[model samples]
Structures are given as structure tokens and as C-alpha cells.
Target: MKRRFFCSTLFFITPLLILACNGPSDPGSNFSSGSVTPPLFAHSVKSLLTLSVIEPADPKRATALGQYLVWLVQIDRNGEPFPVNAISIDGGMPAHGHGLPTQPRVTAQVSEGRYRVEGLKFTMPGRWILNFTVSSKLGNDRFSLEIDVGH
Candidate 1:
């Protein structure tokens, strides 16, 4: 009876003690969290489109604690400027399992293939996944990039 009670206490307290020392994690689950460095320019999963970040309208928006941000990017299909009818943005921290604090979207087509995205607000410093879905004349495709937000 004493051994059974001790075993039960060990099972429950071990996890808490481990977490008290440091948070628990699954190596496979957060594979991209701190290991991989995402590229500034990336190709779609199907390789049908190319997405490139022109620059942050203000460089500080990325590291600014509470400020919203605007971004300019160019989309290309087959290595040329690809105009799109619409672009939708969605993202979150996979480790935290929550979506973005704001619903960011493509505000305008700045020029041929260049687009303006706004309403990006990061609530915390962590590894965030930014996903862009492009809807165009040819077809629909998606671009995903991992962003390491700094404190």
C-alpha cells in the first residue's frame, strides 16, 4: 500500500518538478522553433509562385512590443510579376497553438505584382508562422514562412 501511494505521487509530481525547472517540449513538434532560419524569399509548396518581402514600411515594427505593422511584397509566377485578385494572410505560433492577434490582409496592389499588407500585430516574442494564400487567374497557392520575433 505504501509503495502504491509513493508511485502515484511520483508520477504526478515528476512532471511538475520538471516543468518547474524548465518547460517540457516535444522535439519533433517544435522542430522549426529555434533551429531553422526561414528565408526572406520563399517559393510556394507547389513551386508555382514566389513570394518576396520588399521591406517593412518601418523596420522597428518587427521588434516593437505593441505596434501594428505594414509590409510590401512581390508575388511572381514563373519568375515574372504575377498579379493576383486577392491574397489572404493567416498565421500563429504552432507551439502555443493559437492564431494571430490581428487579422492581417492585403490592403492594396502597390504596383504590378507588388502588394501592401497591413494589420500585422504580434502579441508576444516567439516563433510565428506567417502563411499567405494567393488567389489568382491561374490558380490558388500558399506561401508559409517562419518568423522569429525578438524581444
Candidate 2:
């Protein structure tokens, strides 16, 4: 009788001890690296303006660590290409609580409504939000492009 009671207690307590040591499992706690789903690189800052990313492509290709990348900016109004007075670009990962690793500048206007972005670099694979401030005679509007940099 004593031996049977001890075996049953050991079986129950053994499983409980194993579970306690491992802790609870969270389904959403998985850390995904690289291969992030691409986001639509377009947004309407306001009725007067729309912004889009034209370079590096959506679902940005696998960029090696510490490599320089170029971003292209395009603007439109009423379905037609329109140029803004000045465009400023900046980016960061809100989830990571950090900003970009480099300061990207709109070096030149490529055409009527397109601009060339230079000095862009991604240090890691994650989601980054690119902020574009479009200033023109009408006013100023801000837009964002969510980019996924792969490893």
C-alpha cells in the first residue's frame, strides 16, 4: 500500500515540476527574423498629396549588413504627378524604440514629382517606418512608408 501511494505521488509531482521549470508557453512570443511581409509603400498624407516609395522595391531584397541603399520618392495630386516645394525624409522602428542608423537626404529632384533619396542604410532585419514631409505652396503634409529589411 505504501509503495503504490509513493509511485502515484511521484508521477503527479514529476510532471508538475517539469512544467514549472519550463514556464508557460506563449504562442505570440515567437521572434521572427527577416522574411517580413512587405507593406504597401503608398499613403495619402492628405487629399492634396500622395506619397510612394519607388526604389529598393517593396519587400526590399535581402540587404547585407551595413550596406547602403537608395530610396526613390514619388508624389502625386489628383492622379497626376506633382512636385512639392521641398521633401524631407527620416525613418525609424517604433517597436524597437530607435531611429535610423543614418541620415538620408533628398539629394535631388529626379523629375516633376520624383526625388532621389541617398545615404539610406539598414543595420538589421525588421520593420522600419520612413517619414516623408512634403512641403509645397499649398501646405505641408506628412506620409509614411513601412519597409521590411531582410537579412
For each candidate in the order shown, give its overall lDDT on alpha carbons.
Answer: 0.80, 0.75
Model 1, 84-146: lDDT tens per residue? 888889999899999999999888889999998889887888778899988888788889977
**Number of the top candidate by TM-score?**
1
How far is each candidate from the true structure, as Cα RMSD in Å? 11.6, 6.9
Q: Name the candidate that leads on lDDT.
A: 1
- Tens-place lDDT per residue, model 2, 27-90, is 4347655545554356656767777666656544423346786767778887777888887778
Clashing pairs in 2: none
| Range of the 10 consecutive residues with the lowest summed lDDT in candidate 1 | 57-66
List the candidates' TM-scores in order.
Answer: 0.68, 0.67
| Total clashing pairs for each candidate | 0, 0
Clashing pairs in 1: none
